[model samples]
Target: MNVRSARGAAARLAGRKGEIWAAIWLMARGYRILGFRLKTPQAEIDLLAKRGPILAVVEVKRRASLGAALEAVGHDQRQRLRRAGVTLAARRPSLAGASVRLDLMALAPGKLPRHIPDAWKGE
Candidate 1:
């Protein structure tokens, strides 16, 4: 394969591995993982989890720094996440009454995953 294709494949593989690591971290922290790569018409949520009565829609960024990771989630991305959360709640009635939160899971280079719950207010 070409160099570009090989690099793309490698990146995708690394991303998948990062997601697994993030999920494991969350599970160990007493969060129950509900789904990964959940897609809606608006956008894709990297992970969906439950910690007690709260429903967390997580965005995972595997980046070189926490700032870069957080920067990756911009205004449009936040809107998409809000829409996706609405869609998710509609599809799963059980989650309708649960408190919804937008979360960020940043996997910085050579560091543990950072879980930022309610990362954004969507204001």
Candidate 2:
């Protein structure tokens, strides 16, 4: 494989690992993980979780630094996630009553996962 492709593959694996870590972190914090890598026409949600009446569409980013991870989810991505969240709730009858939210989880080496609840309220 070319160096670029190899880097891309490694990045994908790291992201997948981060998603798993994010799910477990949320579960540890009392959130029930509904799904991961939930894909839709609008966007791809890294993790979908629930706690009480809240249904969270989570985006997970893995970077060497927290700042880099946090910066990864920009305005456009947030909007996409919002649409995905709405679509998820609309399509899932079980999640209809829950209020959907866009959440962010930033993962960095040797640091705890940083979760931002209701990270964006985009339409």
* Residue-level lDDT tens digits of model 2 in 1-123: 999999999989988988998999999999999988988998888999999999998889877876787678888888888888888888989887889888889887898999988865544
- Which candidate tops lDDT? 1
Residue 28 of model 1 has an lDDT of: 99
Model 1, range 79-105, lDDT digits (tens) per residue?
889788877877897787778788889
Error of 2 at 100 (Å): 0.9
Candidate 2 weakest ten by summed lDDT:
114-123
The TM-score values for the models, in the order shown, are 0.94, 0.91
Candidate 1 clash figure, as a count:
0
What's the lDDT for residue 3 in model 1? 100
Q: lDDT for each of the candidates?
A: 0.88, 0.87
Candidate 2's C-alpha runs over 4 A off are 121-123
The C-alpha local distance difference test score for the whole of candidate 1 amounts to 0.88
Clashing pairs in 2: none
For TM-score, the strongest prediction is: 1
